[model samples]
Every structure is written in structure tokens, then in C-alpha cells.
Target: MDLRLAVYHAAREGKLRLLQKLLGGRSAAERGEATSGAGAGVGPPLLIAARHGHRAVVDYLLEQCGARVGEGGPVSFDGETIEGAPPLWAASAAGHLPVVRTLLEHGACVNQTTRTNSTPLRAACFDGHLDVVRYLVGECGADLEVANRHGHTCLMIACYKGHADIARYLLARGADVGRRSLKGNTALHDCAESGSLEILKLLLDAQARMEKDGYGMTPLLAASVTGHTNIVEYLVEGALQQEEDEEEDEPAAEGKKDPSTAGLSSSSSSGQPQVYCTREAAVEALELLGATFVDKKRDLLGALKHWRRAMALRHQGGHDLAKPEPQQLVLAYDYSREVSSMEELDSLVTDPDEMRMQALLIRERILGPSHPDTSYYIRYRGAVYADSGNFERCINLWKYALEMQQGNLEPLSPMTASSFLSFAELFSYVLQDRSKGTLATQLGFSDLMGVLGKGVREVERALLHRKDPIADSVQFTKALAIILHLVFLLEKVECSPEQEHLKRQTIYRLLKCNPRGKNGFTPLHMAVDKETTTVGRYPVGKFPSLHVVNLLLECGADPDSRDYDNNTPLHVAARNNCPLVMSALMEAGAHMDATNAFKQTAYELLDEKFLPKAMMQPFNYVTLQCLAARALDRHKIPYKGFIPEELEAFIELH
Candidate 1:
């Protein structure tokens, strides 16, 4: 066995004599030399012993052999292993309290983090190792407030893993109850997500705030989404109690206040309202928990009123109050409108656009003009405009929104990617109808081209400057594909040198990335597939485009690139009865007789019967067959199954 494995096994099996022989027999200098010479596999023998609860081996390794206790253990990176770790973390994770105590007594770093930034306290808390957790914090002085790589504290992990006792102990030891993760999720949110009613109660008792996360998900909403009925019920009860307390306190405070003084006091001067679950969120939670509403309309109207008040209170303290986060507000609006529409309640005010606009303005004021939230709301409003048949307003809104987004967000950020997709969709819609002359007349060609040119430049910059272009190559390729299609549509115009350069660069980037789309087809395959279709026309099936195929070929796309089915671009074009594409491929020197997994060649797969009736008028199957026959002849290949007479008969029938 390898020296590392031998030492590991000796420790794991509690062979104290063998472990001693491996290291304890050596002097301090010799032991150090032995450990130093051991490869990455030989992690600190102390960690191995501690992990398997070999207390005797751990003591021998640390006390006699003088093994370092603070060294980190093995970490896997891209299928290769690198060993290192603080032995206390491994011991605490394994719930070996004796090993943990022994290591700490020997001066192991109690709060030392592993490769993943996880401390011994976090490991113990995650595993619900009560004794180990207690010893780490109580005896070894482990930091309870430290968070791991994902910003999860001991309390959050305990709640997430449903370790109620561990969570209680952490709270008792003064863990921060209101601490949030990078995504703003609290311990209560974890408890709700885990469906642990006991942990949920513990967190609530510890005064865990019920604020929304960055995604506008509160604990109640999280519980509802996960279908946790009991937890949802508990949260709802807590919310109701909070509301009742506020109501009871309201009248007494009102009675004590002077009417003359009240006139001068602004709303901001009043005490901040306690953060609780919004009524809309609570009702939605209850409904999702399988609770039926008897008076649905009344409940919805009441929820709407409650949300409006919450929104007002959120912005009451000027800049002191929390900024407007629209997800929850949008949810409220959606629910209100949905319920009203379902019950046909005409009496309810149904102006969602105005409400959304108000929310957007408040978010911009609070979160600033270039915040991702602001951009998101802008995109949402632009989509609303698009849906209302106001294309001009929609395009203008997206243009300004993209400009704002470009200022703050990186080009490859999800926010910018989403905006790009939406912009591309709207642009495609306009191009689809440009040949009809209505869109061209409404927006002058120069203005339209200018917008398109700007979009192309943005996409190019994003693709070129992306941190990991290959990982995000699919999205980049799709964006470039859209740009190329737009460029094709503008072929009639006298293009600027810059526009022509962008078109060429865009095609080159698309080919260089060689992005395999979700369907497993490369950009080359997609280009050919798109070209098979008629220009300015939606094909009922596969319509061939010679223009796109020629463009991709010029950009050095593999003419014979295969898709998921191992069908080359020629096979696809031939299977779809695309005569023009077949000709283009043959001219590009595509393998004429390349066979797919099914052993069917491109020429053998052609079937005129599969052609749509509308397409049969313009397409000549006999001509396509003749082209295939000529290519076969040039290659000195004979027709296998069909005789000369049969070929003539088939051509005559076509």
C-alpha cells in the first residue's frame, strides 16, 4: 500500500502501534522530513485519525510523532486531489468529541477554516453534533458568528439541516438572529424551507426578522413554495399576533397625541412599522397550504389594501426606510388582479401599469438609477408596452433601459443577458414584418439600422470581454445568430463600412465559439437549417436559405459538421428536400456519401413525398435528384439499389 494510505488505514483502524511505527518512532526532525516528502495524498495523519474517531492514534500522532494539527485535508479540483485541512474541522464534522478535545488541547486552531472556508463550528453545527459543537464553542473558543463561503452562519446551517437543539444552543450562546446570507436569506427562511416547525419557532423566538430576501422571498413565501403546511401555519400565526399587537398599541398612542402637534408631524416622524409578513403573502401561503377561502373576493381586496399600506410605509421615512423591491409588490398586484378577474369584480381598481410605474419610480429613487432592480423594472415596463401593441414605446423604453444597465452591470451579467434576449425578441418581431413595408415606413430605415447597429456592438463587446466565453458560449452564439439574421434582412441597404465589419466579426465570433445549442446543433448546423427556409417567409417545415449557408461557409464553418444524430448539414438539408442547400454543400466540398449512425447517406435520405404541398410548387425534386446523381458520378460512385430505368421513372413521375 502507499505510505499515505498506510498511515490513513493505520489511524482509521486504530492501530496505535502501527501509527507509532509510521511516525512516533522517528525523532521530531525525522518525522518532519517524512511528512514533507509525503505527496499530496498524505494529509495530516492527525486529521485521518480524528475523522475516524481513533483517539489513541490521534494522541500518538500529535504528542509523540509531532504531526502538525493545523494542516488542511484533501480538496478535489477538476478531478485532481490536493490534500490539506485543519484536523479540528474533520474531527468536529465526524462528531468525534474526544478527538476534537485532544486536538484542541494540543493547540489545533479551533476556528481554522478548510479549503471551502468552513470552520469546525460550522461542520459540527451542520452535522448536529451537539457535544462537539458545545466543546468547540465552550472550551475551544470557536467563533459562532463566522460564516462559510456561501455566507451561512452556524445558526443558519443548523436551521437548514433541521438541528433544533444545535440551533437553540447557538441562540443561547448569542448567535446573531438577524444575520443574512449573501442572498439575504435568514435562519428563519432556512427553517421554513426545510419544513422544520421546531427550528422555525426557535428562530422566531430569537427575534429573527421576517424581511424579504434579495429575491423578495420571505420565510412565509418560502414555506408556501415548498408546501410546508405546519411551518406556514406557524408563520401566519406569528404575523397575525404581530398585527394585533400593533393595532392594540395604535389607539392608545393616538389618544395620547395632541391634535395640534399631529398636524405638524410628518409620517416619517412616526415610529417605523415592524417588519412582518405581508397580508397578500400570508393569504397566498395559506391558499397554497390547501386552505380554501370562503369569501375570496373580500380576502383579495383586503390583501390589496394591506399591500398598498405596506408599500406606503416602506417609503415613509424618506431615505431611512427600506428601498422599494418590486418582486413582492408585483406579486401583490398580480394576485389582486388575478382574484378580481376570477371573481369578475368590476368595482376593484385594476390599473396595474400605474401601480408598477409608481413602484419603479420609488425603486429608482432609493436603489438609484442604475441598480439591477431598476433595470428589471424597466424591462418589465417595456414588455408591458410591447404587449399593448405600442412597439415604438417598447423599443424606446428598452433602449434607455439597456443604456442604464450598461453603465452599472457587466456585459455578461444575467441582468444584461436578460435585457439582450428581450431586445433581440422585439427586434426579430420588427424584422419579421419589415418586408411588408409598414414598419419601415413607421420608423425610418436609418433609425432602425442605428438601433440594430448599437445592439450588435453591445453583443460583440459582451462576447469578446466575457470572463468565460466558452461556458457562456451558447448565449453569446444565440445573440450573434440574431444579429446575423438582422444583418441578412438589411442586405438591400447601402451598409456602412463599420456595419459591414461588425457583420463579418459577428459571424467569425459565432463560428469560433462553435456553441452547441440546447438541441445539440452547432452554429454551422443552425445556419444551414435557417438558410433552407425561404427568405421573409416562415417555413411550414424545413425551408432552405442559400444566403446564410454561404455566409457561414465563408466564415469557415465546417460544411460537414454533424448534429446529435450524426447527420451532417448536407444530410439535414437533403432530408428536408433543400435542393439549394444541397447544391451549396456540394460546392463547398461536403462529403457527398457520408453516412450517419443509421448508415443512411445524404443522397439516400432524400424523399420528395415529405415536402409540404405549398413548397412542392417552387421546389423540383427531379432537379435535386439529378444534382445528387451528378455529384455521385463525379465521385465515381454507382447507384446501389435503384436501377437506371427506375431512376428515369422516378424522375419522370416527379
Candidate 2:
């Protein structure tokens, strides 16, 4: 082994004497060679010991071997380690307070950063090392506002890792709550993505703005997309409360009028209701407030009052009089779509409908009904209606939009593709809920099949018309996978020979399309791409359609195919905590022992600390245990109670 490797091993293993012997009597040139391995370079012995929390080895390396405490060096031979990090950074990253103190006492810079501009304070915060973070900010005078290469502040990293205590300490120490990442996400956004409800509340109380990120996603929408139900509820409640508070303050600022002298008639001077001009506005207000009563009964009466006031403004032409510019109208429409998606997840229907209607009206007026932009808004409105359980209306709206673009747009246009996808998704939903008197039930199976077949042919024609259709395009592959997945779902129902032929053609197209798309994800990966949530397990039998996975498997997709990160389908399933997918992959003999590029087994990657919050879940703990049991069984190892008793009972019972 290289001398640096030998020294690194000795220090990491806490063999101080061995580390000293390796360094003693070595020439300066040899010492440099030992510290500098091939490529980046293995970190010095002191850094190795500090990173492993070997206090004695670190002390001996510094005090006895005369290792320079502040000396910066290249990365380790593994090529995965950080380059140009000082000993203090390693110690801080590992949460070795003693080693950190020793290095600092020996004149190490407290704020020294890595080549990525990641400071020791950020490392400590990222690891949830509260004591070390406090020491760095409070005693060592580390800059709280410093951001890493990704522009993540200590507070943001703390929230991102779900370290509530560290976040609190950092906030108390004056860490800026408004500091944003390179993506323009604040600490609150990090908390939302991480499902750190406690940290989210802390940031909210500290006045973190509920602003949109570069992707036009609010913190609430981010939480919803990640399926953090608790965070979603909290954010919604907070928004309602802020609106209430603002309403209350408005009267105070305007000075209260004498209610006794005010007109008490049902009609205003203009012969309209005092609160609203149109009956539609009144009905909408009641519906919006009434929808909340199902789950948010506590806010019902207050919300009703607030709605009346809002409607009064709208009735007085609040929307038309202060019409936003065309650009602002588009932005408003985008925000409405995000809110509509969140409401769909929450099963709340009223607010999204009202928002969508407002956006659609604005777009129709500004862009004209036949404009492609108006058609896009129409498609969005259809989605909102579908989410609201009005499948027939959703289908009609989408069909109208498609009709408007039939001659004006190219078959291969992105807008046309999106419309087809919308129809496919809505039709699939209708099929799934056929017993619920959905639109598909009204239309016979043959009629639905006709619509689906037409869509398939249009998509196929578009794909074939493209020059060099086989050329790799991530967007095309994703679109093709979605269409095929829908076709696979339709395959479960009985079909005529023509419909069956179309289905087979769709499947052939998907199979022929390049599976290796963006981030090296195969079509199978895109089919089940929902992020895992910390909230709870998805209800039984509600997993996204398994037909996609089944079709891919039957078509000879390698179960152990690795992505760019070398994560196989099993690894993806494990990280996403999709137990149903996990079962299917395991049944198909997926490689349970397959490891990622980081040498993490599928079981080991089960949404612990490293993955984004959206990918962490309490249910993943159970999945981890189950996967562990499966691994042991595969190896013919005995069940020796290595797992928790409850888990063992679950495995045995199942």
C-alpha cells in the first residue's frame, strides 16, 4: 500500500503508535508523497483520524508528528472525497467536537471552506451536530451567512436535513431565515421538502416568506408534491390565518364605521345584494367556504365571513378593474395550477375550481379563445375539473382544446402531446373509478376504447413523423412512456381486435424508444417517479398502476439495470418506499444485493438521512427491515432476531 494509505488506515483505526511510526524518520519528500496519493490525494493522517473521531490519533498526529493543523490538502484516492478540505472540516463533518477544538486551538481557521466552498459550519449543520454548530457560530465566530457551493446556508442545510434542534439554535444565533439556495429556496422551502414540520413551523414563526422558488413552486406546493400531508395542512392553515389577520387589520386601519347607522337592507343602492352583485359570486363564495367545513370545521364561520368580503370585492369588478398585464396573468395562471394540484392531493375541490375559473377567464379575455395560450389554459381547467371529480366535463374541455388546435398546430407539437396525455390520464382515472358512475361508465367500454385508440394513433403518427425518431430525447421518451403506461392500464379491460392491435402498437413504440433518458432513468423509472413521503403509507391497492412495471419486465427490461448513480430498479423502489413495487421487483428476481455507486445496498439506501425529505418516510423503516430479512433469506442465513421483534413477527406472520 501507499505510505499515505497506510497512515490513513492507522489513524482511521485509532492506532496512534502505528500512525507515528509511519511518519517518524520519513523524509519531507516522502511525507509529501504519503499525503499526496494518485489523482486528488489521500487526506493527511490528522484529517483521517479526525474524520473518524479518533481523538488520540489526531492529537498524536498534530502534537507528536508535528502535522500542520491548518494545512489544506487534496481529496482521498477514492475520488469521491471532497478536495482541498482542511482537517477542521473533516472533524466538523464527522461531528468530532474534541478533534475540532484541538485543530482550532492549534490555529486552524474556523471558517475555512472546501473547494466547493462548503465551510466547517455548514458541514456541522448538515450533520445535525448541534453542539458543534453552536460552538462554531457562538465561540469560534464562524460566519452564519456564508453559503456553500449550492448557496445553502447553515440554517438551510440544517432544515434540509430535518435537524429541528440545530435549526432552532442557528435561528437563535441570528442565522438569516431569508437566505436562499442557488435555486432561490429559503430555509422554509428546505423544511417543506424535508417534511420537517417542526422546523417549518419555526421558520414560519421567524417570518420566512412563503415565496416561490425559481421553479415557481411555493413552499406549500413543494410540501404537497412531496406528499407531506402534515406540512401541507399546517401551511394551508397558516395561509388562512394570515388572511384572517389581514382582514381584521384592514377595518382597524380604515376606522370602524357605525354599524347601527349603516344600511341593513338585503339589496344595495344598485339593487344588488350588499355583499355581491351576481348570484354566481354568492354561490361560489358559499361553496368555497362550505367545502372547508368537512375537515376544517373550526374555521368554518370565520371563513364564511371572509368569503363574503372577498366576493364583495370581486362583484365590484375587483378582477376586471385591476386586470393584470398579460405576463402577470400568465404567472397568475401558473400559480393557480400549482394550487389546484395541491388541492387535488388534499381532496379539497372548491378553492382550486374558483382559482382555475379566474385564470381561464383572464386568459380567454387576454389571449383570445383560439390562441394556443388560451388552449393551454383550457387544458389546465380541464385538469382542475378532473381533480374535482367531474370527469365528463374534463373530457369535454380537453376535447374542445384539441379541436381548437387540430388544424393550427402540428401533430408533433408539445401542446398536442400534452393534450393527448391529459385525455389519457383522465380516461384512465375514469376507468379506475368506473363503478363510481364516472364518465367512462356513461360511455360504453367500446366507446372509451375508440377514444383511447384514436389518441394512440395520433401519438404514433407524431412520433413517426419526427425526423430520426430513434434519436435519444428525454422529453420524447417520457411522453412515450406515459402514453404506453396508459395503454397498458387500458389492456386490463377487454378490448376489440382493433383496440388490441393499437395497444400492441403503443407498447412496441414504447419498447423501441430509448429507455435511457435524463439522469439515465429508464422508462420503468419514469412510470413510478412519485417521491416517497414522510406522512404515511399510500392506502392499500392505491399504488400507481403496476402495469407499466409489468409491461417493462415482460419486454426484457433488465431488473438490475442501473441509473447514472448505479441505482437499480430495486434501489429506486427501496428509496421511494414503494412496497408494492418492491414486492413485484423481488418476485421478478431483482438483485437484492445490488449496490449503488456509493456502495450502498438497496436496503441501506432506504431513505435514511441522506435522501431529500420528500424521499423519507416512517414506513421506510418497515420496508428496510423487510428487505433486510429478504437479503438474509437469499443467503440462506438464519433469522437470528437481528431485526426488531415486531418486524420479525410481521415477517413470520406474512
Candidate 3:
């Protein structure tokens, strides 16, 4: 080992005598020899000692053995350094306070950097080593202003990790509290991410910036995601109070004697304070600031009220807001509406607000609810409410918009069926309130089944009975397939064996019509569509038959059936990496070599990236077989079959 590395090792391992002996034996100037793991045979021993936390060894080499400190560069045990952090940086990161102190004391440069362009202080701070940081910054006077490769300072790193004391000490010692990272994140950003109220208040007291990040996120926005409501309030309150103080200072300044005017014969200082900043402007600025904080949080209700009042002031001052950005309009609606309940038929109606008692009042005040021009408004509002814990309400409103096929469609009309399907799909997914069991029960699955069944029979009868075969009848057939899928999903939950059998038969019958049959599914696709039931309580399994996919293929349901995307059933199965489906598709004559629009083969689309070795066992077999088959079939090569003699004999006898 190099002399410096040996000294570093002795120091890290607490080998006081060894460190002392090495230091004393070597002349001070002689010990400063720089050795690299590069051109030379071996690296300096001090690098090893420091890398292993041997503080005593490090002290002996530097102080007694006379080892010299040099500039840090790429030096890795495993050969993967980014910029140039050496052994000392490693020691600091591992919380070897003693080693850190000894290095700094013995002239290991405080601001020394490595291949990654990271300083020792940055390494300590990033790893949450407060003691090492204190020793470097307080005792040795390391530059607290130095930033890492990513432009993050010790204070920013400290705040990000919720190290309140380190942040306080750094701030007291003149660290830039408002310094932003490469991404424009300051100490406030770090503190907000930590969700630590104490750290956030410390940064705020130091006047750390509350400005937006590169993506326009403020401290408050970070706090919201972490669910730190208190931290969010603290930052907002500080900004608000600061604005108030500025308001008071403006008036006092106006009352002070004016030097320029006093020199002129006709000029005199005002005895009373003249109004420079108005009460309205002060209120408005504070309101707008509050609105900004809330808006960053996407707290729709709070923001809407604040912005509305602020906008009122703007209008009074004869100002107009730039056309609200699409995103802002989205936020405005998010704060404004509520959903109530979902109808059995899937039609959604908005929850009436008592705040607007009359229709005309509602139309004038609130953006006309459910109006075509304002659909997105209601949709966004409903979405925000869903995100804010009012799930039932969100579900109701979403259904209303998605299901409006006819203005006055009856319970079982074609329009009603269309509306029901739209509503069913939306509610089945979105509302999902377990508390609505009573309402779901009242709606009755049997009624839905009857309507769906009637529709299915109507289509089948038309297909079998009609001579001209009106092209429009395809709509009824598609509706019936959708209904069968819904029924198939429901049967898995509470339906009897007979109902299940009926559902299976309906699926089979629907498959015979084969709406998108050529791409890989018939009515039997429900066996695989993993959507939830109407009540949303149970997870309906993919298809019932282990052999259902095989049966579909045998019965002429296309193995390559795709929806609008032209993706074969084999494609969906492969993308999900479902081995059974893949096998069935291959056995059923799906072209293994087919590529999607992305020009990716079914095998290539399987995401094996970063998967654990153990969990990958299944995918391994499936991918290999699929790819092997594709290669063989492409060249007209036949694959040999594998079957037991007993199975072969049984098949021959049958």
C-alpha cells in the first residue's frame, strides 16, 4: 500500500501505535509521496486505510509517518468512480468521524474532490453524517458553499435528509440557504421533500426562496405529495406575514422627509403618511400569494376561492387575466364540483349544490353543469374530488358524462343499453365505493343480465333470421358482446353455477358472431378482460377455462384477433407475459413472427429489465420457446412434439 493509504488505514482501524510508528519513522516531506493505482504497481496504503475507516492508521501516516495529501481522482476498489472521490471521501461517507478529523488535521485538503467532482463535505452531508460534517465545517473550516456535481450544497443535502441540526449549523456558518440545485431546488425544496416542519421553518426564517422549480413546483408542491400539510401551511404563512410587513413599511417610508424635495424651496415632507400601497392591493397580493401556495398543492377548493377573489380585484382594476392556461382551467374546475351517486344504468348526474338553489343561478354562477362547453370542467372537478377522498361523488359525475346516449332514453331501450354500458364501465372502475353495497343490491344484477341477455338474443336472432342483414345491426351485436363480458365478470362474484354456465354459454354464443374474431377473440374475450365487477368488490379472474383460449382457437376464433390496434390476442397475451395464453396462441396457429406497429415482436415487448433472477424463471421459459418457435416457423422448420406414450395411446383409443 502507498504510505498515505497505510496511514489512512491505521487511522480508520484505530491502530494508534501503528499509525504513530509509521508517521515517526518517515520524514514529513518524504511521506507526501503520491502513488496511483494507475501506472505504478500498487496504490498508496493510506487509500485502503481510509476506505476501511482506520482513523488511527490515517493519523499516524499523515502526522507521524509524514504522508502527504494530494488531489483526489478516480480510485475505486471495483473501478467505477464517477468524478474523483478517493478513500477519504469514502471514509467520510461511511461516518468515520475520527478518520475524517485526522485527515483534515493532518493536511488532507478540506475542499479536495474526486472523479465525481464531489467534495468531502458533500459526501458526508449526502450520507447523513452530521458528526463528520461538523468536524469538517466547524473545526477545519471546510467551504460550506462548495457544491457537488449536481450543484447540491451541504445545506441542501442536509435539509433533504431531514438533518435539522446540520442545516442549522451550516446556515449559522454562512451556507447559502437559498442556493438552488441543478434542478433549481433550494434548501426549502429539500426541507419540503423531507417533510420536516423544523427544517422547513429554519430555511424560511433564513428567507430561503419559495420560488418555483424548473417544472414550476414550489416547496408547497413537494409538501403536498409527502402529505405534510403542516409544512405546507408553515411556508405559506411565512410568505403571507412577510407581505404584510412590507405593506406596513411602505406607508412609513412615504411619511419620512424627502431629501430632494426639502432642498427645493416649494417642497416639504408630509406630516401624515400618504397611501402608497392600498389595503386592497395588500389584501390582493396576500390573497394571490395564498392562492399560489394552494394552487401548487392543487387544492382546488381553496385555490378557486382565492383566485376568484383575486380575479375580482383584477377586474375592478380594469385588468383581464391572460386566457387561463389549459392546466390552470383544469385546476379551477378541480376545486369546484362534487359527485354524489352512480345510477344502475350507468348514467351520471351532478350532485346539486345548495350554494346555488335555482337552475338559473347555477347556470349563471357555476359553469353550466353537464353543458357540452363545460364538460371538461365537470370532468376535472369530479376527478379532483375523487383524488380528495369523495370517491362516490366522482363516480356519479363520471358516469353521467360517459353515458348520455339519449336525452330521454328508457330503462331498456337501445339508447338506454348504450348508456348503461358506458355508465357500467365507468362506475365499475371509478366510483368503487365499498360503502355503496345497498345501492348496488337495489340495482339488481338480474335486471342488468335480463337487459343484456335480451340484447344478445336480438342480435343473434337478426343474424340468423334477417335476409338483407342491415349493416347497422353490427352495433347491437357489439353491444351484446360488451354485455356478455360484463355478465361474465359479475358471474364470478355471486352468480350461481347455473348463472355461470349460462354466462359461459352466452360467451360461447357471442364468440360465434366473432365481432373482432379474426384478431384473436370472440364473445370469449371476457375470459381474459380483467376488469372489475359492477359492485367493484371482487376481482373477476381472467378466463374461466384453462382451455378456453384453446377452445376459441379451435372453434375459429382468430388467434391473432386484435382490437383497434390490430394486436392479436397472442400480442396481448405476450405483452402481459402470460405463458398459458402464449402457448395457446402458438398451438392455435398464431403467426409467431408477426410484429406490431412499433416494429417490436411479441417476444421483444416483454419487459425483463431489472427483474430479479428468481422471479424471472417463468418468463425465461416463455420467451425462449416463443422466440425459438418464431425462428423455426419463419424458415419453414417443423418442431418435434413431446407427449407421453400413455397420452398418445389414450388419444388413439378415443
Candidate 4:
């Protein structure tokens, strides 16, 4: 190994002699790089030693080598680096109690934080380091409520990670239980979501109140969504008992009612208002949980059981419980409805597929399409179909999800980009010859052409309102390559005049928008370049095709359009060794002797093997008009104001 890396290894392995030897006679830049932990993926020597519990190396570096005690560096734990973490935090998080004690003894601050403001106390609580936690909080005067930048306290982390003993210690140390994070999630919500029933009881015993998150999700609903049956059952029982207690404690005074129960109950035959209404919220939670079991867990029987319980609770005790209605009809679900009676819920057992569809419908209705889980389960169900060789059904569902993403998500969103990439990969798969035995349906012109048209529309929509994005963005380049491949696929299919016209019309729209990607490569430029073939994981399309090039030229693509390197389409074709495409561009009025930024012509850029087999020669390209333009430019003759604009532009092209 190199001496710089050897120093880090010695420090990490606690080899004080090797580290002492490597520490002497280093260059200024190398020493600076080591001390700052800013070298190529290596932390400081003291940080590495402290993280691995090398107390001798730590003491030597700090005392003998004068290493900075509070110097922050990148330290890793469990395969993820926490940038700007002090040595004390790293040692505490790793449970190296000896290193932790040494660092603190050397005057390392107990409340020092990472880049995200996660304190050392919070770090110790995260991994259940009880001794480190005790030292940091009990002896060193660490603040119990010093949360991270997201407002997550030490108590919250302990509860979420199921460290019940650590949580008890924090509770006794005056850690706040009701403090919420930036997303409005408390300790109760975290324990509920993680299914830590022991921690859940601890927080409940501490009187942690039930509250909704930023997405309006209660702790009960969060438990149901994660499919924690034990926690959900326990919380549901508690909710019922609490409702009973509140009802019994209600006063019997005339014309006076509890504030939460006023105007809540529906009228009965007795004309006396019933105030026991906690079952309404419980029924909704169970119904939503049933949807989770169906889509997230793939448990049809379990989903039916939860929905049956929800329906039973909805009707029992004469409460006014009802499932919410959809604001608009969903064509993807075939206009599904919630089953009103227990018989309807039981009838779902006969047809498992219908029950699956109902799960999707209920999730979308409750979560709404804007929420990520709504589209997630939709695409997930589609993928399941693709895995079972039912690709036609898969394509239909994926198309619905794709359109839904386009409508709801912002332009150029990753989810939308992923949907487009999925279509490209799917089209490439079913068109392969090996898929012929399993796929019953044929890949059609309409299927490929339809997505291509939508893809173009999505690009147009992005450009309609905002300024055009930089073409070098990764997302933009991926989109451009995918669009070019889609056009390449359209060439293999046989289309009538109108279909072909529509195809040309779609290409026309894209060309009119004049979008570029990755070093200003236009559609025509990408069609003739070889690098576009590596845009996807699988083989989507080969570039430099004569057919794709000719179609782009016929549909308003500029023949001599230049990229960012000042290389025109002919220049790109020459680099790719596409003789046919170069000839087509030359025939379409491309300048044969035009120079790029490298001052090399298309004929000069061609490889030597192709030079002997070249279709167009130097003698054929040389003309008196081109010679006159070059001579004028070489001798500095100025004729710009004297000539017409088009003639002057042509002279400059040389």
C-alpha cells in the first residue's frame, strides 16, 4: 500500500509504531489531507483509531502527534459515512466505550453534532449503547432534549429502535416524550410504526398523547399500514375501553354535552343522543389497514378479516360510521365501491382478484393519487403480472400508472422518468424472439407509438411554462435517449398512411420544440451517434441507422445543426464511421468541407480503413465557392455588412 493509506491502516489497527514511522517526513499537502480527513475516501488518523477502539493510537495521535481533539471528519458506521462527525460521536455510536471515555477525558464536547445536527447522546441511543449513554448524559452533563435538525429527540430514537431499557433511562432522565419532529411524528408514532410494543407501552405509560402526522396519519393508522397486527389489535382494544370510560364519565345534565361529542351522534328512535363515537375512527383505521394487507402484504384472507372487523365495528353500538365516498370516479379501478354489509365482504372470498382490485381502489381513495403509495401499489401490481408472464395485463396497468404520474407529478420527476424507462424496457423485451413462445399478444405500432407520443407531450409540457432546462442534466439526457430509441422502434412496424402521418406529426412536435440533451446533442445528432446505444441497461436500439436518420431529416430535423462542441450532425456521423448517414446529410445540403472546433472536416475525421472505401472523395468536395470563402476568411477580408444575411451565414459555415 501507499504510505498515506498505510498511515490510516496503522491508525485504524492501533499500530502505534507503524503510525509513528509513517507520520514522519510527509509532504505538506499529504499531511493536510490526512488531518482534514479530505483525502480520497479516507478519514483522519485519529478518527479512524477512535472509531475502532484503538485507545493507544488515539492517545499517541492526540498527545504525541498533536491531533485536534474536536476536529470533525467523515466517519462510517454500518456502511454509511456521517460527514463532519467528531471522534466522540463515532466512538459512541460504535459502542467503543474505552475510546468514548478517552475522547471525553481529553475534553471532547459531549453535545457535539454531525452535519445533520445529530448529537452524540442521540447517536448512542440509536445503537442501544447503554454505558455510553449513561456516561454522556449522567456524568458529562449532556442535554437530554438536544434533538437533531429534524427535531427527533433521544427518547424518540430509543423508542423507534426498540431499545426499551435505554428508553426507560431517558424517561427517568427527564427526556420529553411529546416533542414532535419536523414531520409532526412523536415517540408514540415511531414506536407504533416500528412495532415495538414494549416501547409503545412505555410511552403510553408516560402519557404520550395520540396525534396525527403531517400526512394526517394517526399512530393507529401507522401501525395498520405497517401490518403490525399485534399493535393494531392492542391499540384498537384500548380505543374501545377509552371510549367506554369517557361515556360513563359524561354528565347527565339536560341540554349540556361534552364538547367532543356534541352534534356527533346520529338520531335514533329513542331521540336520546349517544356519545360513544370512538368506534368510528377505529372502523376507518381497520378499513385502511385492510387495504394495506391486500396490496402491501398480499394477504387476501387477512385483508378480509380486517375489513370484516371494520364492518362489524362500523355497525355495532348504533354508531354513525361510514366509509368515505370518492370525490370522482376512477377508471383504473373500474369504479369500485366499498362493501356496505358483511355479506358483501364475505362474497369477496370467492374471487380473490376482485378483492385485490378493491384493495387498490381503497388505497387510492384514502391516500389520494398525490401520495406516493397510491402510485407505488399500482405499479407494484402491474409488476406482479409481468413476473407471471401475463405481460398484456401488466402493460395496461403500467400505462394507467404512467398517465397518473404524468398528471399528478411535476414535470421531469424521477417517478415519471422511471415510468418512461419501464415502457422502453418492456417494449424491448416482448419484441425479442425468445419471448414469442410465452407472450400471446403481439407488440403493436399503436402501443409503441402511443407511449412515444405521450413522452413527447411530457417534454412539451415541461417546456411550455418554464425555461428550457440545461441539456446536460442526467434526467434530460436519459429522456432524450429514450425518445430516440422509441422512434427507432417505430421504423420496424408497418403503418398505413394515417398512422405514419401521425408518427411524423409526433416527431414534428418534438423537433419544433428543439430540445437537446448531454452536450447539446439534438435528436438528429443522437440518431447518428454511437454513444446513444448505452443509454439503458438492456439493448433498446442501435444508433447510426440509415432509416432513423432519413426519417428525422424528412420530418424537419436540421441536417447541419451543431452540438456544444461545434460539431455538426455530419461531424458526429464521421466520428461514428456512419458512411451512409454522412452521405445522406451531404445530399441534404450539409457542408462537406465544414470544420468543427478541432478544425477537422468530416472527410478528415473518417478512419483510415473507411477512407479507402469512402463514397465521397476530396476532389468531389472541393469547389470554387468553398475555396473563395476560406481564402476570404484566411486573409481577413470583411464583407459582412455588404452581403445579404443568408449568404454571409453560409460563408461563415466554412
Q: Highest lDDT: which candidate? A: 4
Task: Using TM-score, give the best candidate's number.
Answer: 4
Task: Give the whole-model CA lDDT for all candidates, comma-separated.
Answer: 0.62, 0.61, 0.52, 0.79
Off by over 4 Å in 2: 38-41, 64-84, 238-654
Report how far residue 484 has shifted in candidate 3, in Å. Answer: 16
Error of 3 at 119 (Å): 6.5
lDDT of 1 by residue, 1-654 (tens): 755567767776789888667875667786654443256456666666777789988777777766787867763333655345577887888789988888888888888987667888998898889999988888777899899878899999999899999999999999999999998999888998899988876776677777778767678767754556577666555434444444455564434432112212112223543234544444445543321111212234343453444333333222122323444333212222222121222333475444444434434443455545556656676777678766776676677677777777666466765665565456556655668864433443454455556555666567657666457656655554555555455554455888667666666765675555434566556656644232223321123457767877887888877766777887778766777677777778676566666767677777858754343222233356656655665576655566778664332221
Per-candidate TM vs. native?
Answer: 0.50, 0.43, 0.38, 0.83
Can you write out model 4's per-residue Cα lDDT over 408-451, one digit (the tens) per residue? 88877788888888888888776764445757346688989989
In model 3, which runs have C-alpha deviations exceeding 4 angstroms?
1-94, 101-120, 126-128, 135-152, 162-165, 168-178, 192-208, 220-438, 441-587, 590-654
The model with the greater lDDT, 1 or 3, is 1
Error of 4 at 74 (Å): 4.2
> How much RMSD separates candidate 4 from the native structure?
5.2
Estimate the TM-score for candidate 1: 0.50
Q: Model 4 off-target regions past 4 Å?
A: 24-41, 70-75, 81-84, 105-119, 139-157, 169-184, 205-209, 241-278, 327-331, 433-442, 464-472, 535-537, 544-546, 570-572, 589-654
What digit string (tens of lDDT, one per residue) describes model 3 on residues 432-461? 443565343333345445545554554564
